[model samples]
Target: MTSRPLSILDVRSAGPAGRALCVEETAVFQHPLLEDPPASAASAEDRRRYAILQRRAEQTCLACPLLAGCLYDAVVRHDVAGYVGGTTARERARIRTLLGITVEPENLDTLAGVIGGNRPVDHDEVVRLRAAHPDESLERLAHRLGCSLSTVKRHLRRDRNGGRTREQEPRSRPSVRAVLATARTVLDPARGSRRAA
Candidate 1:
């Protein structure tokens, strides 16, 4: 599929509270895609910069409150840009295939804009898909679910071990922006100076 820019939000549905806790407000605004793309033609330093940027972008997403919502939207709409829910556009397509959700023209509409129009991937579908394809590799399963392989393993293992997937529990304390900054500095202290805006 051709890459196209998505609004990320079709509406301010999550509102201020959800928006405030978003990780995009941190490092992602610097690049069009959430992460910088590595190019073989580029210098070694350039490749390293891209890698650092991608890692920090992922770390920011991990700390966001609306991660689930962001991921769900990306998977449902076949988002064509950025690291959403830690999955790329190709991964989202795999998920859409697994969930049996056809991407109709109107699938682009936000859930807030039109209720009951899109089918988001659900936990049950994930479980069912895993069960139906028991021999499938965890990475394949994660790609199908638009999640990390570890997550696929965790959910299935947790269930088998008699534990439910944990909810997005409230995080205890600390500023997200500050934490994000610290992570970036740790990864590459001179990122700003090393790369020109």
Candidate 2:
């Protein structure tokens, strides 16, 4: 699909105007949908307030005349998170699943282009990781990628800390039998008979 510019009006418009249906606000920024749920990381009081706002926002969105259009946009965009035109992550995931669309939000830029979402990770993070670790190790790279060492190395061709190149393969393990045999020979040398005068 072709990318299009996101308009503030598209986000802020409220209520019906003409044949296009009223602007959707509640669905676009449903307070309840935006609030961390009761089982979230917020304080108890904050959670209570969030629940209240969420309820009101849900009510407003439900009554909005542009609900259909908002739903269409939210579903088609494969938005995995946030209150897009009124749908939550759960709602969006369900819509995508029903439509046979993959629901992963790995490519945040693509999602943002379609659903007006923010990038999950940015290049600055990569630059910072590189700067902080001038001798970058695989472990550090993995942490930055939020993936396993192998996965990080696969994508990142160079180490940020300068420890090793990402393309460096694992060295083969030493032969255990060879090591044991060498150790035995070193520990037990043949003794020559000494002449007693």
Candidate 3:
């Protein structure tokens, strides 16, 4: 059987699906899908801006044409880091939940440079641990892992990149933004409505 093609907007339009994408999109912004940031930016505002960038990236993914392919690749490979097809670490978890798989496919090798020879944690696991231990600090965990504090914090941060705490629990259902996006499309398939707007 052939799998249905997914849209970046579709990933974000489905309440549960979109929120999951938001989590991964948040990671891509904090750590970047490309390169890691310099160690000097330990300030609070700098981190805040980095989060903003992640949310913007999710928005970008929502608008991209290849989002379906990206999501497929991410799912097949079990990617545990960065944004793909507008989905976040949390979003991927939802996918896993849907598929009923437990193993992860995203390589931890992408973290080689960021952790300075330390084996870094994957984004999905980080989300789980953060959820499991809401009182813990990502920085403290990184210290124990012998990696940069930012790297740890980046994993814990939500995909939305809003001012919310990294440890906040996710909604059991789709978010309002996601429902609106789908509803708008259903109402009028001609004109476009931004998902994260």
Better of 1 and 3 by TM-score: 3
The sequence of per-residue lDDT tens digits that candidate 1 reaches over residues 109-195 is 233433245444455666888889976655687687765443454456456746553322223322333322222322243552344
User: Best to worst by lDDT, what's the order?
Assistant: 3, 1, 2
TM-score of 2: 0.38
The segments of candidate 1 whose C-alpha lies over 4 angstroms from its true place after superposition are 1-17, 23-30, 33-36, 39-43, 102-197
Best candidate, lDDT-wise?
3
lDDT per residue (tens digit) for residues 41-84 in model 2 = 55689667765665555555555655445655444533333444
| TM-score to native of every candidate shown | 0.37, 0.38, 0.38
lDDT of 1 at 191: 58
Clashing pairs in 3: 15-174, 20-91, 21-87, 21-88, 22-159, 23-88, 23-159, 24-88, 24-89, 78-106
Superior candidate under lDDT, 2 versus 3: 3
Where is model 3 more than 4 Å wrong at Cα? 1-7, 10-28, 31-54, 105-140, 148-197
